[model samples]
Target: MKRSRFTEEQIIGILREQEAGVATSEVCRRHGVSSATFYKWKAKFGGMDVSEARRLKALEDENAKLKRMLADAMLDNVALKDLLGKKVVTPAARREAAAHLRSAYEMSERRACRVLGVDRASVRYQAARPGDGVLRDRLKALVQERRRFGYRRLHVLLRREGHAVNRKRVQRLYREEKLSVRRRGGRKRAMGTRRPLETPLGANQRWSLDFVSDQLTDGRRFRTREALSLVVDTSISGQRLARELDKLIARRSRSAVIVSDNGTEMTSRAILERTNRTGVAWHYVAPGRPQQNGFVESFNGRLRDECLNEEVFASTAGARTVIERSRTDYNHVRPSAHGGLTPEAVRLNLAASRLRNVTSCAGRPLPSAQQIGHQTLGLS
Candidate 1:
């Protein structure tokens, strides 16, 4: 019912004015009300005081509230009867139940949803995500090729292929596809005081050398010497080691220091002569302490785990080819810990930054384009 504009006290005062012999038309005109409305007010509150009128309003409010409660109880009872023995746990299931109630029982959506305990928004929700068929296919192919790669590495590969995907999305898809790499148990070692190794600030500033060995199909053994700064050379003798060292120095420029374990080839007179000729300091770790050259040791561990254990080479030539391809990927394709960039990309970026610093000194004029080109070639 619509509420009256005049308060109960004001109505009583108006009635008293009428009782005091004021004209009815004058009273209605003074209050800006119609005669019909005045008459209705008179019929309802003619003899009642302000207190009685307030009490009547309070009773009316309580009665309306009770009616609403009764109606809700009836709705819940009917819904329970309709949904007997049916489980509605998920939002989807609740939405389905509400939809069934609306269609089968001619119930309104608001009432049906209230009874089924579902949000109206959820009932109207529709999935609008794009399909991932192509992405899933590509992800599976990468997993097949690099069986030991984790989702983080796979995410980097996908980005390299121009996929514009998020790492979390790749992780979700990886879990959904069950492509997790199983971790192998490690051997226990003697506990000792651990010290963190200092990281090199630039490429070719420090290099580490280590040999990784594997067997051919006929059980013949071969070894590959890996330079932890992204160079690998296959050699079987100390003489070949010296030649490879010279080739590495010529190709990659001289390093300030070379770190290695105290193996015979690394400590040989030929290697010492080569280092002296190139003016490169060769630092040897203590005997039986491979952890002193941790960088190359870590690389050898990964090479053994990810490549050597997975491949069975039939000949030395095939082994060299496969190892060379792996080295290329390690430098140019595989992601490193350096902000997800490959080793080659990191090296190029560092070199470019250094060249910019050299050519753009604060008080000096910019170098010519020819000089810049020469610097670029030298850095490369």
Candidate 2:
């Protein structure tokens, strides 16, 4: 792409001299060019005037410009295809993408920004935000203290400790530090028509029972029997289950119906006798349908996720202590799905609602026994 020493007008003038019967040798000698150069010019502009040569030069310039533009458009297309499906919401991410396009596709900065649909100023912007070194160290310490906590829960903890940081900032640092909790793959769900289970109307109306098993550090296994929100650890026997149920009933009101899966511990003679003695109805769900008894199943999932999976119990006593603490936290401290209220809070709220209903009914006249019997028989 070296530029020629002669302009188009000069080259055309020299060619005219050759066409006017001047010797090509004389023309070359006068112009300090070789005969080859003169003949090359003659072949190009032999029948062209200066105006035509100028027009040809302009066309060549325009064609070169168009070629450059087409090449840029093709590079932009390639950059866009490469960036497809990639989330570049942040300025830092866009800057990185711009750099990638420049290195990968040989695109200019302006072209890269245009192709990425980001402003060039944004791509060139330097972040002036303060560093999170201290915050990150504190966050990692909190993570070590509570390894089972996710970013949202950790954000809550940070706020409790009086850290003036945004939740999004914490999330960003959480990702950058690679502190994400590893999750197990999901199991395939059974697909079919599913009937919803009847919801409990009151505290002592219904209860779900389930067992969760885990191992001590010595590899000794233990089983925990969960009754709705209650958790008790014991040996894997129906006698122990009955004893645990008795203790649970002693502390709380006896439920009218107890739901459990078709496990041996649940269907054993000891459990059946205990239920009969307590005048409680024992119900068994279908063999592979754990969802039929979902209350305890959900609790067990949380226990496994937030407690059992996070702790290493050295002994049965240690396991019991940790599990009891986790149960206390779950019932009294941890927020439940009932509008972020804990289980204890929900129980208190339900009790308050029932009291209000009773107080409101206090002024109403009592129904006669015969009327109650008719209502029970669904008579008008």
Candidate 3:
């Protein structure tokens, strides 16, 4: 370092002269310092005697030395951190350091940790964690068993099996072992919004019609008209379907609305003309979507599962007998999941409920079922 022209004592003397009202220019000229330098000295050494000024200089020298030492220590720390980042340290790094210290310098584990600037517990850490191996084996077995299940399902199963592990731990191991299920590639189309099928409050208010086909013992195919009443026959044509529907409507009550799919037999001219003449509203479900007509589809599924699949029909008469018996049992004997009542009981209950406040087409009291021939129609 270059030495200063004036000592601390001389600088303090110049500032004291300025304090005693001497001209600043005269002081600068006498000291051979510029007015700016005089002002700088005044600012630094203002209101101090020579002793205090020398003490301040000594304190500044000590502070500079301390700062230089601090900077050197910080540089060493930075170097160590960088080396550690470049894979200089592993989980076994601390143990090796401890062992080196013990062999080379005869230092204990505690002294080695202090010298190496590492945590004591980290230096003493064991390679195997408690139950880690067993947990990994269980996770692998579970993944193999449930090929389609994901991490969430595995976590649930693990919990059910009395494992006290958390979902995050399971997920971490699952990723490490590459146990994720392969996802299907194509974008999946969504089924449209599902709405419940309309239920009739009375017998003739609404009716659902669907056609079900089955093979006889002789391998000949036959279709059944499933509606309020099932009509089984060998051959099913548009005209035959229309005639059967008309007869069903007459035998039961004339329906106001009929729900069905857009099948050829249903949309034929004969069936359309019959619906128009009878003043019945025909509602067709969306094409290729059978779920929209869930009522008849569900009934057909039940008939197939319970009766059709078990019985082998020999003749049309035998088929009709078996189907009629099954239909009767379904209507009168089997308790429906819907409202905990049989189909017949539900119809009767709905009719009775509406009858308390219902009237007839002529605005007259409708005769009871006992008085009429079981063909009473209520206000829709």
Candidate 4:
């Protein structure tokens, strides 16, 4: 609800003017109110003087205060009942309450325990879980590395890595260290569902492309314009984009499909001609639906959060150097969700697998040119 700007006395004065022979429309105009608002005010404060309106305002405020007090009192009563009769106190809570009572009332620890109905030994006991600094540091590092993984998955990974820790303890440390993943909330009506992109069966089968924008130290804005090929174009255009694609295709095998957003560069005649010349398919995401190009979008997010935001690029050369280094780390050094292998490692593994498949086929002819093009490769 929108709050009214006028005070109670001001509202009553405006209503009183309408009652004093001023035209209703004139009164509304003077007071900056609509006829509906004037009528509503008149209905509420009609026949009341300034003193009477003041008294009525006081009564309304008092009523609100009383309602709040009543609510708080009821909540207190419930809490007291739970503490005395119904609730089961956990060890942590028991210790916390006992310590509070002992300090606040200057009571002995034994007396505090007796009053709280908790054992003195339990109150004095300290948990041995997540005991050492090394364990906490490792947990922190894991959480930083895997931002999306919650306590359960983190616990599983820790166990796999031979960390003898309990899930509940991991969860407790996760809360205490505040390592929970904070996912961005989207619009309620925004498209939430994404059709999964067809996963390629071999290397060079498919590629995803997306652009990420950022600014340098001198306030000059630049976009990291190409992925997969690892080219960072200063300007975004069809010619620039097509040239990068040509370079990538010349170096690596032509991918079957290049997935991208419906950007002007991707749709331009130059890009279209290049794709046609290379005999590769271009698949565009729906307009305004970036999530449809999820792989590249995810890469763009990491590029911004981990690299671009961390660097102060003084010039195009500096920007390129930083971005290229980060891209290398992303593709070759950083472990991906694909069984903890880097993207380069995964691609190499897939290529090796394809090679073995061909070798095992002895008499069969190797895959044709078109079939080779069907193998996947990507840039984002």
Where does candidate 4 stray beyond 4 Å? 1-90, 102-130, 137-174, 179-196, 225-227, 351-380
Worst 10 residues of 2 by lDDT: 371-380
Residue-level lDDT of model 4, residues 277-344, one tens digit each, is 87899999877677776666666666666676567888878777777787676666655555555567
Candidate 3 wrong stretches, greater than 4 Å? 1-201, 225-227, 357-380
Query: Would you list the C-alpha lDDT of every candidate in the order shown?
Result: 0.72, 0.72, 0.68, 0.69
lDDT of 4: 0.69
Worst 10 residues of 4 by lDDT: 369-378
Candidate 3 contains a number of clashing pairs equal to 0
lDDT of 2 by residue, 67-179 (tens): 99998788678778988888899888899999999999887897788788889998888879888999999999988977777787777668767999878999988998999
For model 3, the run of ten residues with the poorest summed lDDT = 371-380
Q: In model 2, where do residues sit more than 4 Å from their true spots?
A: 1-47, 63-90, 99-108, 115-117, 124-135, 159-171, 185-193, 225-236, 352-380
* TM-score (C-alpha) between model 3 and the true structure: 0.43
Q: Estimate the TM-score of every prediction.
A: 0.60, 0.69, 0.43, 0.58
Candidate 1: 10-residue stretch with minimal lDDT: 371-380
Could you give the candidate ranking by TM-score, starting with the highest?
A: 2, 1, 4, 3
| Pairs that clash in candidate 2 | none
TM value for model 1: 0.60
